[model samples]
Target chain A: MKKPEPVGAVKHRRDTVLSAIVSQIPYIRFLGVSFDRHGDELTATMAYHPDLIGNPMLPALHGGATASFLEITAIVGLTWASLWEDMEAGNIDVGTVQQGALLLPKTIDFTVDYLRAGLPRDAYARAVLNRSGRRYASVHVEGWQDNRQRLFAQATGHFLMPPRDAKH
Target chain B: MEDLADGMAVISMPYDEALIGDPVTKVIHGGAVSALMDTAGGAAVMAHPRAGVGTATLDLRIDYMRSATPGQRITATATCYHVTRSVAFVRATACDEDGDLPVATATGAFTVIPGKSKT
Candidate 1:
């Protein structure tokens, strides 16, 4: 008989899922991405650095960087959801999982629209999972700068999830 | 961007630990590949027949077929396929050293900046 899971336990489980995916991505660390979780929602913050600037005239954050950031957010969100599902089904234990317990999600296709120049400052992104199936997941993501109301980019992507034992 | 023959611009990204998407598999992140392709697309606009014009990415779409082999030089080449008064269409491919098949293919449009008359 499984007992009712408390809110804290659920949050902790989600954090484990998020970290498991985030820790594997070297580019995420290179860009200084920090994650924040509130009630089940995850948002990523990218710290500004000189190496990320593309347009020296405007001293703006590279558009490519903005797109990548938002895309990563989407992938992370979906990976978290997938892991959580695995936990609920009693398939895997989040605590004792090894580094390669889950295969990295592969991007099938991605589209990015640059709404405006990414200014030289911290950028924030959040991904909304649109749909998830056995083999594929679709996500919509957006990125904003200082003001959340103003968007810097919008992206939509599809990711392919291979079987656990299959090689990507 | 390094100039290649036939009006192509190429950008090379070294394989480094900082680019790995999966530490266990050592796969390069899709974002890094996207960035490299985007940069190549913008460079293609700069190397267009009507050079000396600044351009910004309007939209970029990438289709990833496979993971870039780890510990190999990733290179992206961009070619400007079409040009209009206000927009330039570019296509790019990112591949590893083997170069038999592209890891990803990208198509993008860029806003063209007017340059001073060469006359």
Candidate 2:
């Protein structure tokens, strides 16, 4: 058997596959959700555009647009975290991380609280995995624009994942 | 000049490439569904008897009952359930051509600005 690639190498491959999957998502593509890593956390950024306005009066970002951005961020964060955790535990078979990320988790539920109207500007969101159980994962996500101290929205979502032992 | 019914609105969106979440599966993205529901909810608020000059979404909860079928128009019908001094409650369901089952359902609260703000 060929030698297994290093975890770093596997991660690079996984990122490429995952990014491609995310890009193919039409809404994500239209909204321009981009991912970046700072230290150890991932941040999702959405560029402001005129098409995202729902209320022409305040010229605010559509509530659905904000909610969707947070939701996508949380889902993507969970996917990466799950893959990495599985790999670190040696539970993930070699050459399967990419496939794992491709199999997007099914969203079980989503809730969003619009704290304030999102202005017409670039928006950012960060998601934290609160709990990763055997069959389900929960994530909390917050979105902000212009100033990080003032959040535009907050959301929580649950997604269905396969059991730890199940094949990807 | 035509008059529309009160507290009721319907929004229809076709399944296009821009709404697809998975190109391979050709399924509509959940976010697009949420946007559709939100827009419909806002429209209902606009048509309400007690509609304020303006409104904003306060909270929304969405349940994805199923993925919308590929290449089918998805429509959301929203009705304002109640309106108080400061809030309006709206519930909506999105469905494709597949009978009575809904692709998704959402319940949301909207902030009703009783009158136009002078600011």
Candidate 3:
């Protein structure tokens, strides 16, 4: 009978997968973005940096930074969602993907709603997958600081899904 | 903002690895392009001939047409198409080395500073 994989190996694989996913996205690293994962769900964080400011007169975070943060959240969140089922079935093994990095969805359109001025502070966001099909997907991301209920900005993005048959 | 005139503005960002979205393709992220377009739109609104003071983005929609070439600076131009008592509308586009082909196009609404003159 085949034996179950040990817990340590499973944890190592998970860590490797996560690192490979993030490190491969240079923009996310450049923006100092990080993620906290719970199963298939992800919450992204961007710590405030001086370079993040666009209008220093108002001392507000650059709208672009906020927008980028939200979009990356959605993309990475979707990537995780795609991987969850395989991981659950014990099919996710690190160093197997010939694609080198996690396959990032291509953005077709993104609409951002700037609700409030982004203050100079750490920001948090979460992405909700509105719908995903074989060739198209939509995601909504909301960003906030200090309070989760009061969002500083939100975005709805539609993406073109990569071919599923393309080996992972 | 490199240049600003009546109802128009232009901005550009040089290519940097830090802004790259696709590690494999080395293409800049749509977010970076979004930020550029938003800033350009706001600049256009603030520079409008309608006695603008300050402005805030209410909503901005961007449609990406193609991936930007790696290591090419991106430039965006925005035109304030219309204005009202409390809002301004802007249309903008971004492009890279292939200046004729736009990387993305955007339309946005921005809040206009209150108190307009009768003239």
Candidate 4:
């Protein structure tokens, strides 16, 4: 357990850990969320599918899907911050594992405004960090289809961060 | 009937059996209405062929004007009004088949992502 081998020493560790965790999340995988880093922003995109349809008469996108997208974005934002901070502290190895634990303990207090009706077409969402602290973070996420805005969801979530076990 | 329009969609269902509460005999599930609003708004955004891959709803707020009737056909329409670099804003309304008055209204924000397929 040599102090988890310093963060810098595990440059690709965050990605590996995230990939593994994301792979096991069926709903997320089904949503086809792909992650990319742009400076401080982390973006997630998913294609529209029939499975996410809410109303058969209208064949529109489901609000649950929209909420799910927002939730995932919030999780990613928190994880991103955790990983970034760990890397800065040269303690990256614990970031992912710690993130997984925190994610399980996190709760969402989301507020959404249904501005417009979404089509049966594809859609995507992006989460932006509004603020972040030691135990909590707030994010403003938006979802779109074609080039228009379909849903706006935001939340401030609190995550319990505990130190990794001695095994790490 | 006017073509579904760019950001418009219709929903007609039995309110009696579909709803959950007794106080409101013809109670439309809030979730169901929200879903309809999302679809309409999403479609409005995707109306343009050149639009990006797809969009996802970030948040939605709905205000119920009045409860709908049981076994009645309801229509919902959503339109995307503004779109910034990464954010899209939309507004919507739901009503019965006659289109006389709105049963509910909603507003939402959506984020557009590049390289994704439209739903």
Candidate 5:
């Protein structure tokens, strides 16, 4: 029997880059962000606990949680995309690269549209790469809670490429 | 009715491991700082002479300086900058036992729900 073909190499590289990024954000480690990749997109899920509650009467998931969730997703998505770019360019120093070099494109503006209220339960977010270019990248992220959609936050992030003479 | 001259009300809570972002490292989460800011902002509005007015956060921006350690008592002080016919602007900061450096700084905008008296 022929050996099964190896899974897509890009995905394997993406996961490695993502795990590195998550490890840097200690808060994310506490929040328990789990990452899963699908083709070019990535999804992250975080479980909410009682300590994150802002309003006891309403039991609303604090907006800060929502903000952190969005920020993490953006960072992860950009890191994943940069990994692919580095691979295509035959650069192996991606691990030591700074965020500015990896995000080559800058996010000029973004918005988050809260669709529904979140409960003290698990929250999910998915980041989709809308466009990736040399100077900028756009990503759309949506968050869900208790199986209901809660937020739609997008980032138009810019990443600065390495300066000429810098070894990559 | 609580007097307006009392200045913005202050509330503080002891930091705990749960507030720490890393269970093992004991670094407080930035979100926790933001939450404390939000709570302080709301309490400042509620402490105003006007009671029964609901306040919802419109926008909040926080600048993080350093992370708080677990088991440190965090004191939050909120000051109401202005209260218009419908909007209230507030600023707050969080400090630990040392009180020399701020862990986080935040500013927020709140809108008073309809049919509520300022007093």
Candidate 6:
């Protein structure tokens, strides 16, 4: 009988998947944002900086920062889901994937609801995928801080999937 | 932001490598454009003749009409189209060098600050 892959190997592959995809995007890094992976899902985190404050009186985070975070979380979630399939089927070379082979999904449209001012503090967001079809995908993302149940902002996003064969 | 008059505002962002979304094409990320529009929308609402003390985004919807031309500055223009007792409605568009063709368009509703006015 053939033995299954070792846990360490699986962990290494998981790490590779995230690093390869996340490292290539400069905006994510420029915003000081990061993702924590759980299985195939990703939760994005952005640290608070005085530079992010928009309203001096309320000291709230800029709406642009909130929008970027939500949209980025949705894109990363959609991209990772697509690649996980290839990785599982053993169709992807980890080395090739790391060589800037990943393509960021295009935003077709996005809607954001600002429930409350984003307090000047660290924030967290999770993308709940609605659909991940080959041609298009949609995601609903929620952002919160301190209390997960209390969302400061939420968004619904639609994305155009990248062509797999690079012919498009 | 500038030209905040008659319930309208304009804001612009120059091309920045850090704002690029697609590493291959070098197109700026749509999120950056969204932010520009959002700020412009807020400025428009505050500049409205019936303006308020402060405004916050209630909801915003954005459509990406096309990819922004890389290495070009993008400008957003917002107009506060309507205002109610508690809400202000705004529409905004972002364009690069190609002014005729918009890179994105947005419509949003913002809270109408009570007891505030431009006059």
Q: State the DockQ, from 0 to 1, for candidate 3.
A: 0.82
Question: Which parts of model 1 have CA positions greater than 4 angstroms off?
Answer: A1-7, A88-91, A164-168, B4-7, B115-119
- Per-residue lDDT tens digits for candidate 5, residues B1-119, read 12234328566767766554433346665555666676777777766654334565666666666667577888778878887667777888888887999877777776655567655
TM-scores vs. true structure, each candidate = 0.90, 0.87, 0.92, 0.48, 0.62, 0.96
List candidate 2 stretches off by more than 4 Å. A1-18, A86-101, A162-168, B1-4, B117-119
TM-score of chain B, candidates 1 onward in order: 0.90, 0.90, 0.94, 0.74, 0.85, 0.95
Instruction: Score residue A16 of candidate 1 by CA lDDT.
Output: 72
DockQ of 1: 0.74
Q: What's candidate 6's DockQ score?
A: 0.82
Can you tell me the DockQ of model 4? 0.09
DockQ-wise, the better of 2 and 6 is: 6
DockQ of each: 0.74, 0.62, 0.82, 0.09, 0.16, 0.82
- Which docking class does model 2 fall in? medium
Alpha-carbon local distance difference test for all models: 0.81, 0.81, 0.86, 0.56, 0.61, 0.87
Q: Candidate 2: TM-score?
A: 0.87
lDDT of 6 at A27: 81
lDDT of 1 by residue, B1-119 (tens): 56654336899999999988767679888899999998888887877766444678899999998889999989999998887767888899999998999999999988877663121
Model 2 chain B weakest 10-residue run by lDDT:
B1-10
Return whichever of 1 and 5 wins on DockQ. 1
Which parts of model 3 have CA positions greater than 4 angstroms off? A1-11, A96-99, B115-119
Candidate 5 CAPRI classification by DockQ = incorrect
lDDT of 5 by residue, A49-113 (tens): 78666567677766656656765676566656666656545475546643323322222333334
Candidate with better lDDT, 1 vs 3: 3
The sequence of per-residue lDDT tens digits that candidate 3 reaches over residues B1-119 is 67999889999999999898987789999999999998998888878878456778889999999999999999999998989888898999999989988999999998887875333
Question: Across residues A1-168, which tens digit of lDDT does each residue of candidate 6 receive?
Answer: 978988888878978878888887878887788999877778899999887777888989888889988998888888888888778666778887788867778999999999999998899999988988878898999999989999999999899988878711
